[model samples]
Target: MTVSALTRPGERDRLIVKLAELDWVFILALCLIAGAGGLMLFSIAGSSWTPWAINHVSRFLICLLMLIGLAMIDVRVWFALAYPIYGVGLLLLVAVELVGDTRLGAQRWLSIGGFSFQPSEIMKLGIVLALARLYHGVSAEKARLSWWLLVPALMIFLPVLLVAHQPDLGTAMLILMTGAAIVVLAGLSWKIIGAAVAAFLAIVPPFVMFVMHDYQRQRVLTFLDPESDPSGSGYHILQSMIALGSGGLLGKGYGLGSQSQLNFLPEKQTDFIFATLAEEFGFVGCVSVLILYAAVIFMALRTAYLSHSHFGRLAAAGTTATFTLYVLINGAMVMGLAPVVGVPMPMLSYGGTVMLTVMIGFGLVQSVRVHRYAEVTSGKGSFV
Candidate 1:
């Protein structure tokens, strides 16, 4: 046999081994979550998804392609584009303030060819990249100083404030949490964290009263006392609680949920999806779903820990934290522990743009995982 032919089978075998080693758990978790979401969405949309379902399915397929494509790219490329992408995100946020569509009182969407997308979604990933890049190159000694580390804090808060000004309290709060988690993981001192906490507590009252809308304030109050407006602001929560409790220990069975099939639960497939799921699947099902999410986050964080590059590590950690916030906040809102925030549950909520963006993030984390063995020492990496 010729040398080329002799080596061909060996190379092919190695390639197959590598492909086989690629993490299937993450992909399976995503599929399960999406599957649950699709089932609920189909029911909520009244079993006929001729047009809208096609759009969602198209988005999922496109995102699946992007996930595979992104997984093959080097994390360095995303690191390179971090700044430019953040710049674009800022421009889009500004555009939203100026010429964007005003929907339901807030101008958070950009209308293009009759389709609108929330720029805040893009901002989440962009800010994560930007902050990850910023925090990647720092020495442990440098990270210990509060004054020296405040720059990345600014990078985090600036966009958060912009999001807040759009009155998207949900997105802004998530952004702040994401950025703060990055900073914490980057090895900032606890002293600095304590100071920030103190400052937040001091300033929250004025911010809530002066900056928050009446509706927003009422939501907070309603959370404090849902009984106060059981027929009004608290109606959603009251119904959600009833639906969840009605499921008892073993759920009412799929398609048999009274709250959902009877149209008693509002936004059953969107912000309050957990309610529907809990009603149909019960506590055991809810716990199992939570375990899947926990596993996904655990794997993502493990990838970050194993990564050999700072940018890849920070990026992975940031992606995991952001996703965790999405799941936690949305679940909390559905359970009535939090005020009804418009944030969608990760992978399990109705929305094409967010689903695609989130999966793209997972793809990036996978990219980071695959390259974790390679020692990438330089901070400068391509964004391709």
Candidate 2:
């Protein structure tokens, strides 16, 4: 009682209370994965990364600060800003189409001064927030048979179609899945999900063969049999598989893999980071990485369930599924089980934009968990 009585009540108390309410288990898990990512990036970058590492470390610091700031904000702030944020994001996408940076045959980034950003990443955040707003008042009767579902779909679809126009299939698919997960979590029926899946499967074959770019179609066909063109279309997959299998049981140890050292594995620090982990740490390491991902996803789903408000719940769920898809696509691509779609491994990938956006998403979910019941007085309803 004496110790409790000595404490003062203020912002510090509010901060402490919020911290106490958070899911530390999930936070710790994410931190562990992030730390591992930094270490792996060091190895991948090697002697050529002195400046790159410093800049990336600075980016990580910035990401951490943004996370803290976001986590302390009320959940309703995101809802209030959702539509405007989405509108701004769409405008940026349009700007991207009109006057954007074209690199490696994709017009996905916009450069300002010395810095560049991908509008697709911003759109990912926008779609999640926007969809959460739409699903906030969903009920079984309304959710099952209402135009509300279409509203969210259209919100998501516009950006996805634009990203696909950028010819960035990976991001477009990720955004689509993120929106679909929100719809499903909003209590859309299995009948709907199943039918949607069936329609997608039926439609994809024709699009792949006729509409997709030549190299993109090659990626899909090569995944089915990587050895078919070891010198051409399948080179990346074959090399990655060899590197992964070469690691054997424990691993070849860090910074010692011939595949990466000899420059056989492409995009070693970015899209193919998991392969770097595999080639250095082997099966045990891969399992450890998978376990960390599973833990984060599990806690994220739990956070969604425990959230006090529908908006918070949907945001948490959609964000969790987005993370899951990021990990799955990257892992499968590295293992030669899926086509090379340029999906970056969460936390581990070397891109600053992807890293920052992912961390912000994490912070947003954490904020939702911590401040789920906080009162909103800025033109939105308050819990108090």
Query: By TM-score, how accurate is candidate 1?
Result: 0.91
Residue 123 lDDT (model 2): 85
Q: What lDDT does candidate 1 reach at residue 287?
A: 91
Model 2 TM-score is 0.92
Candidate 2 Cα misplacement greater than 4 A, ranges: 1-9, 47-53, 375-384
lDDT per residue (tens digit) for residues 215-323 in model 1? 9988888988999989999999899999999988889987788998898998876788888888888999899889999999998888899888888899999999989
By TM-score, the best candidate is 2
Per-residue error (Å), model 1, residue 42: 3.1
> What is the clash count of model 1?
2
Model 1 lDDT at residue 105 = 90
For candidate 2, write residues 1-384 as lDDT tens digits. 566555757656888888787777877787788777777777766744554455566677788778777888888878788878889999999999999999999899998898889989998888998888776755777776566667777888999999999989999999999998888888887877898999999999999999888889999999998889999989988889988999888889988877887789988878877888888999999899999999999988888887878888888888888999999998889998889999999877777888888888988888988876754442343444
Predicted model with the maximum lDDT: 2
